[model samples]
Target: MRIVIVGTGNVATVLGRLIIAKGHDLVHIVGRTPEHTVPLAKEFNCSWSGFSELHVINADLIIIAISDNALLDSASTFHTNPVPVVHTAGSVSMDVLKNVSSHYGVFYPLQSLRREMMQIPEIPFLIDGNTPEMIALLENFSSTLSPFTEHAGDDQRLRLHAAAVIVSNFTNHLYALGE
Candidate 1:
């Protein structure tokens, strides 16, 4: 599948690498700044563009892996398209992408991801879509990236995100005390 990834952070970089490694075509990398986007695009050997140029790129899937705080405002910039559009956010609702495309969904990765990690960890994706068909399509696509995939609604994802935060924070606190 041909894919376009938005954002230049950990999630975007990690996911983009995974997509390309799986024999998929990474058509473009769109970010807020050229400084970050250009280098990532060079690494992927794909085109790079700012959010303003997003409408021109054609791809099978567009994944918005930006920060949760920027999602609402950034979502409005995406021109409506027929291709599937998804966000890798755990706390946000899938409806945030409704205006971005006719087919929109959530492609939330359940595990923590860091681009600098020496080994890629097993990521279980929690996915949801606007329609049943869209949900199925996201599930199948997610399966190609990870062996674990599940259908999760807005409430479920939000709850899981909260738990993940608590667990992460507590672990950090323990490490700090140990130190």
Candidate 2:
């Protein structure tokens, strides 16, 4: 499967690595600066491009691994036909890709991912989309990557995200206070 990732950040770099390791093709790794993403693209052996280059590549799935704030804006830069696009965000809704395309979905991995730390790679995947086919495809894609995959709707996902913040973020804050 051809995959295009729209961010060279931790999430994108890690996920793209796994996808490539799984024998899938990573078509491109898009980022704002060539300096930021070019090295990662070389390391992953994928093409590097900026935001405007999104339309130039064709992939079965386009994963937006950019920050939550940049999602909507980054999404607006691409206008692909029927390409299944998914974002890796907990708080953001699937609606962020509202005007981007019909084949958009949410592929949130329910875990705190960081470059310095090695993740378990078996975290629960919160999957949702606009269509049944897209949802199924996401489920299959996720299951291949991890054992835990579930169909979490918008409301459930949002609530889970909030809880994650309290447990992960807020708890971390308390730990910091203790120190």
Candidate 3:
């Protein structure tokens, strides 16, 4: 499977690594900056470009691993006609990509990430697609990476994201204070 990762942050880097490690082709890395995008693509031995090239690029799947706030704006940049478009965000709904592609979904990796972290964490994937067939494709794709794949719709994903923030963020803050 050829996957184009469209983000330069922790999620994109980590997931791109996983996909490459799984023997799939990372066709391109599309970030907002050449500095960020080029290096990430190099790590996977693939080509890369800025968000401006999204409409012209082609891939089996386009994964937008950017932050939620940037998602709406980013959606305006891609064309997912012959392929599917999925975002790795819990808080953001799949509708964000509805206008861009008929085949759209969410591929949220339910875990915290850090650029410094080298070890592959146990990532549970919460996936959803606009149609059942698309969802099945996402499910198969996710399961190839993690056995802990689940089908979570927009509402459940949002609630899980909120709880995740409370549990992970709040506890981390408390720990920092305690230390």
Candidate 4:
């Protein structure tokens, strides 16, 4: 599968590495900042572009791995893409991507991800699509990256995200206090 990843943060970098490692063609890397985007593109050996140039790129899949706050606004830049588009956001609704493409979905990774991590952790992907065909496509693609993948709707994903936040944050807070 040919893929284009947006954003230059942890999720983008990590996913880009995984996609390439899996023998998938990472066609392009798009982000708002060239400083970050260019370096990442170099690492992946793919073309780089700013958000404004997104429309020209062609890929089988486009993953918007940006932050939750930027998801909706970033999605607006896409003018009805033909390929399937997915976001790695847990809290944001899949509908936020409705206008971005005819086929849109959520590919939320339930586990915490950091670009600096020496080894990739087992990511439990919670995926959802606008249609059954889209869902199947996402599920099939996600399975290649991780063994643990499940279908999760908007409400379920949101709730799971909330719980994950509380658990992770609360555990860290306790450890801080212990220190």
Candidate 5:
């Protein structure tokens, strides 16, 4: 599958490398700064471009692995051509992609992502898609890396992410305080 990855942050880098290593073609790597994506593009052997250049590429899937706040804004810049687009966001609902494109969904990895390490963690993917076909495709795609694939609606995914924040984020804060 030809994959287009938006954002060259930790999650984007990790996911791009993993998908490339899995023998999938990463067609385009989009980022705000050239410096952020150039190295990743070189590593993945993909074209490096900005968010505006999203429409220029031909890909089977466009995965937006950007920041939580930037997801919607970045998605708005994309010119949708009925291509399957998925955002890697745990807290945000799939509805955010509704206006962006008809073939939109969430491809969230339920784990803390860091790029330095090559080993992608065994994290379940809470997936949601616009159609049955996309849902199945996302489910099968998630299954490639992790065994657990759950079908979650927008509200359900949001609530689950909230709980994760309390358990993972806040708990880590407390642990740091204790230390």
Candidate 6:
């Protein structure tokens, strides 16, 4: 599958690495900053460009792996048709991408993502899509990396993310204080 990864942060970088390792071609890497995007594109031997240059990209899927704050804006920038847009944000809903593209979905990895983490954990995916066909497609793609692929609605995903922050983030902080 030909994919275009949007964003330069840790989540995007890590996911891009996983996609490339899966033997899929990462045709284009889009980001506002060259420093962040170029190295990742170079790592996969692909071209990197800004979000505005996305129309030229020929991809089956476009993964918007950016921060929660920039997720909606970033997703809105992509043109609809040809490639489906999937955002890797647990807190954000599938509806965020639906407004901009007919083919939209959510691919939230149910795990704390760190770029420094050497091994890819058995990360489960909480996926949701605009249509039944889109949902099935996301499920198949997610199943390649995880044994489990769950169907989560917008509210369900947001609540789950809140609980995760409490469990993962707060607990980690308390552990650090104890240390």
- Badly placed stretches (over 4 Å) of model 5 are none
**Model 1: runs farther than 4 Å from truth?**
none
The 10-residue segment with the lowest total lDDT in model 3: 73-82
RMSD of each: 0.9, 1.6, 1.0, 1.0, 1.5, 1.3
lDDT of 6 at 6: 88
lDDT of 5: 0.83
- 1-179 in candidate 2: lDDT tens per residue? 89998887888877877787677898889898988899988988878888887776788998989989888566777776678888988888898786777888899878777655444366688999889999988988887787888899888998998898789988899999999
lDDT at 11 for candidate 1?
95
Extract clashing residue pairs from model 1.
none
- Alpha carbon RMSD to native, model 5: 1.5
In candidate 6, which residue pairs get closer than 3 Å at backbone N, Cα or C atoms, i.e. clash?
Answer: none
Candidate 4 CA-lDDT value = 0.90
Clashes of 1: 0
**TM, every model:** 0.97, 0.92, 0.96, 0.97, 0.92, 0.94
Worst 10 residues of 6 by lDDT: 73-82
- Across 42-123, the per-residue lDDT of candidate 6 in tens digits comes to 8878999988897677788888888898986666677756578889999888888766668899999878888886687778
The per-residue C-alpha lDDT of model 1 at residue 2 equals 90
- The local lDDT score (0 to 100) that residue 170 gets in candidate 6 is 86
Per-residue alpha-carbon lDDT of candidate 1 for residues 25-138, written as tens digits (9 for 90 to 100): 999999998899999999999999999988888888899999998998779889748888999999999999888899999999887889896467778899999999899889
